[model samples]
Target: MSGLRVIPTWRHGREWLYVCGEDGGTVAWYDREADRVSLLDEARGGDALEALRPFLVGSVAVGPPPVPTPAELAGLALHPDDDLAPNRPGEHLAVALDRDPGPPRRLRADPRRRALAAQQRVGEVLDGLEAAGWRVLHAVPLPGGTYVHHLVIGPGGLYALHTVPARGRRVRVADPFVTIGRAEPQPLLRRARADASRCSYALTAEVHPALVLVTPSSAVPPAPHLFTDTTLPTLARTGGHLKPADVEALHMLARDRGTWTRA
Candidate 1:
């Protein structure tokens, strides 16, 4: 499979880098020494992969932009889903468009307008993260469906799940199991901060840029090189761990964790 060879989201000494080769192949790496930035080892995955490439190849940084304020970080938080809570635990942050210093922004009612609105919601979430100081590395799709929006955020590399309910048919299957879920505002953020070493960073992710794998059950084995090398602080936020049953639908076109990857 000739494609991008990203370092499985990893960490160096005190920093993290998002490595990308050609296609969507990416990896996160960080350590104490030996830093190199540039594309290397272009080939199919697994055995054929060249082991000589350094982790930080060609500026492999992850997460969104950087800002430092809880209020600002609120922008990156997922839209209020009062329905799914405790697991998601907070309501301090909100997603909104940038301040244009003009008239009120409106979302049209046309089909294209609808798509634009959805994309805008996602953009607002990412923007909120940037304003709060988080380096959004790269977004990867989770296998199974387009609905499973899997993302790798921060330097330490954590799995973030974005469920686009409206795009359900576009990517995922019609699974009655996976429905809109939510996390407690405070606890979820607390968990995320602890995971990033108290670095409460940004909380937005680039929309469905790549596809991913959706494990039916924890016992099921995922594809090779499928997971990252980071330690998750809490499973409080959904999408960090792979449970086979959670995934029921998927999009055929998404590339990140897609099944279309030529191997």
Candidate 2:
């Protein structure tokens, strides 16, 4: 019961509740209004309210993960004009929270909810990369309530990757911008670059900027103009520039709490 937690999540932009064990186990997804829970195996066959009653009675965060709080976000001097400024849709809520610095904002339309798919995609890719001798980290917290989704250290080189969820859609990347279906090109390369700089300083190593676009239905192949294609296999195969010791050093730095939380 101590490890039980309920955090806000979404399935395709719709409110979907997520429950998991802090000690690590299969995550359970719920839909309170629908009265259902989604199994890890993609099957749907459980009573959400019934299964979650015990946990919910005494514990539920109902917001973003605990790593970065609103007060924490406020401490960082992330001015509006700063490159690391919360400019995109993803950064707004955290920045807003910083100004107000109160209890976790209500669950309605949490911006972090939108990054769930990207996190899952990045997690899958990083899992494979870890299995294949790559050192990786995910959901790395930084100042200003922002998070570094994925960081890879291996022979290919150190990479700070930002995930773009473009699944089941045609994605075309044309430098500083990416077009997904009819949507306008949302430029996130700068975000990735800023993340890399932060990682570089944290690990005291040069980090490369990269973007992973999760597209299962892209008719066009990845090109340099699109930035490096960051599929699971692509990430697992490339970036072999770090040695074992170097990788260890980076892992050590990444795990060090001061590397990120410090101003």
Give the candidate number with the greatest TM-score: 2
Give per-residue lDDT, candidate 2, residue 11. 22
lDDT of 2 by residue, 1-263 (tens): 24545555322223555554554343465555455554542331233334466544343333222353333233222222221211222344345546765556565544344455456656555656655556666656788977776776776778777877665777776666777778888777778888889888877788888777766465555643133235446655665477765665566456444667652
Candidate 1 at residue 188, lDDT? Answer: 25
What's the lDDT for residue 190 in model 1? 28
lDDT for each residue of candidate 1 in 1-263, tens digit (9 for 90 to 100): 43433332222112333344443334222332444332223232232223324433554323323442443233213122211111111111111112222344545333333333443344334333432222232222222322222233432233443312243222222222222123112222222222232111222222222212222122212322222111112222334332222111111012222122221
- Alpha-carbon TM-score of each model against the true structure: 0.22, 0.54
The C-alpha local distance difference test score for the whole of candidate 1 amounts to: 0.27
Model 1, 109: alpha-carbon shift in Å?
A: 5.5
Backbone clashes in model 2, listed as residue pairs? 154-242, 155-239, 155-240, 155-241, 155-242, 156-239, 156-240, 156-241
Please report the TM-score between candidate 2 and the true structure: 0.54
